[model samples]
Target: MSKEDPKTNSGYERTLTNAHIQLIALGGTIGTGLFLGVGNSIHQAGPSVILIYIIVGIFLYFLMRALGELVLSDLHKHTYIEFIEKYLGKNIGFITGYLYWISWISLGMAEMTALGIYFQYWFPHLPTWVPGLITIVILLFINLLSARLFGNLEFSFAIIKIVTIIAFVFLIAYLLVTGGKTSFGPVGFGNLAKNGGFFATGANGFLGGFQMVIFSFVGVELIGLTAAEAQNPKVTIRKAINELPLRIILFYVMAILAILLVIPWNKIATTSSPFVQALGATGIRNAGSIINFVVISAAVSSTNSFLYSAGRLIFSVTYDGKGKWNETFGHLHRQLPQNGLILSACLMGLAPLVIILIGNQAFNFISSTSTSMFLIIWCLMILTHLSYRKQTPANKLTDFQMPQYPWLDYLTLAFFGLMIILLLSLPANRMAMISAILIFIILWAVSKIWHQERAI
Candidate 1:
């Protein structure tokens, strides 16, 4: 609440409770990626998209385990970037931190962009930019309030998504069991195989699914970031990280299965949510609108989360440093990273303009760009964890160890590497992949040149 800038960024209000942390963890994974992007995932992977989720979930679960262990090792640090700075050196940390922040900004842009698409469900005449621009304004106000308020808002949003998805899965299951009819005819599990079988999309299609599947899990690390704001970092993060696989299986795997069972993979809609499409096809009046509302909520919830993260990350990366960039973004206002929050919110506000420039492909392009950046950041994070395990003396190490040690760490890296290879191999994603790497190198050079100027 102090007016002046603090000398350090060591303290943050640990106001997020166990419930807040848990729901935020749940909320992070079930966003526009699952709701809107899944339609694209299904279109590309077919029914085999189910396996894609499981495979990605397992490795990311291991990623979370390693991240949990790292955060618990040092609760004083505000984010994993600091740990990366400690272990991987300042140059890598600086680049990773900024890239991570920009990635979150990109994610917010994607979510905000989707807001317009969702709103068009009800108000077809509404300009796409209006809803997204308005959403950024509103969510930014909510975020600037307090961490506790943000937690509470996210708790409510997460609950809405959780109930809607759970009920949806159950309804679909019941329909399949009792032979209930839809407008598309009786829903059945055979939809999983009827369209050309599980791997109907073939190996190339299956490989293509990995991109959006990775995008879906992009926010899985939110639990780790929230640890610094949790009242009980150890217990909260462990519970969230441990339960991740189950959450992925239920929210992602089952939800997609329910949608596909009702509408075959080849028949899935790509632009809007397949969830809404499935419900609309049920002959239930207002079903698509209801689910569309929920899908809109999911997008807003994620945009809020990303804005929060982007603000904090920008602050974390710039804290205690010199120069105008640090001076502008590093300080806290009334115990919040006001400058960082405003900056991120403003950038996200431009999402509508980007949508205008790119046309309908804006969301996919923005999400892909974000995913490319995260691939780099996640790689650095896993390396940071491995570096932690290597340097810490056995006697000083905490009991909350990442299971399987170095092997899991190496395997996780390989999975991410494969994702990178896949992205670079694709002509569509090649530009984003190359751009991410170039940004990292540029950031490194800029930091070196800046430091040398200071030394002279």
Candidate 2:
């Protein structure tokens, strides 16, 4: 590590290019949640799962726009929680900052745990925890080198995932048009309508799938996280946020639609990736293998990004703060948050052990837990945006404003609110939701104690 720079809070430079930001935006959304968790969505909602994705995507897009406006309003701020601090007050910022850091750490754990599952397709006998452990080590070394290297790695990984998804959509569409047959039988639109008539599992099933579907969109706002490191934040951030709609249509809607059109939704595998399964059914030599590799790359890519976010978040929250805790995590080395990266990566390294303890269920549990935390964080983020708009006059607002102002904010909040209710009410996700709530309460208490100490 380079000599520590304690005079300044962060060492991050604007080394992340526009292309890096763009692909990071794309790569962020297409991670473990979509690659593997979508199988669970298909299992619960059947073909109707498509609607659930669209609903969640629309709400998150609004969330991104709100975030973008907040970001554009002040380019010097480090992360989203700075806006939370500015608008919602400092205490909320402290709590939300820690919460956001933990959320990203857990997200890394979830993605690493997923690596084992993805690698299983190639080597069924391999231990589930092995791949994740090795990946965490290698990626940690790479991330420690420089911010530009991290951006380059994410850029390449994003390209691989995007190309694979686009190719899958086109190939599957052609197969559907030709009335081609797979092992699951003929590929056609009737596959969607016939098996329980689209709403195969009914309303209960559709609603039950919302938690997983919401989790699938977990990384959509990663562009906000990259703002501090991004070169030309004004142009790159706006362009990425504006193109969200097309990304949703292509990566989520089109890809899943093609998957279901090829293999009946009811037949989708919950244990493995549906994309691999759909391709495997085609009996096309190496098609399934190719997709399995891509999903592994997707997991690795997402894990890399999550670690990057977590390290930066820890540095952002603690930089310039008092106490030994902040002193340990806040400073930078070689203009990078080296201590933060090592600590976050080490915590993520523990994921394999958690995988051992939870067995087959760890990934879903960790992801749902992340979703629970982010739902709360996102609500705070929107509230911050609303507060920003309330305090700053129209003349002071940025050009990239969240259109329709307070109404869109409330609508987005309502949608997220409903999803939280669904999460708490659902038996499968209830535990994760409760755990998240308890963590928030604990963080609130911790922050209070910190305040008392400072007052002394």
The most accurate candidate by lDDT is 2
What's the distance in Å from true for residue 3, model 1? Answer: 27
Among residues 3 or more apart in sequence or in different chains, the pairs in candidate 1 whose N, CA or C atoms overlap within 3 Å are: none
TM-score of 2: 0.97
What C-alpha lDDT, on a 0 to 100 scale, does residue 426 get in candidate 1?
Answer: 85
lDDT for position 77 in model 1: 83
In the order shown, what is each candidate's alpha-carbon RMSD?
A: 2.9, 3.0
lDDT (Cα, 0-100) at 169 in candidate 2: 94
Report lDDT per candidate. 0.89, 0.89
Report clash pairs, candidate 2.
none
In candidate 1, where is summed lDDT lowest over 10 consecutive residues?
1-10
Residue 131 of model 1 has an lDDT of 82
**Residue 354 miss distance in model 2 (angstroms):** 1.4
**Candidate 1 TM-score to native:** 0.97
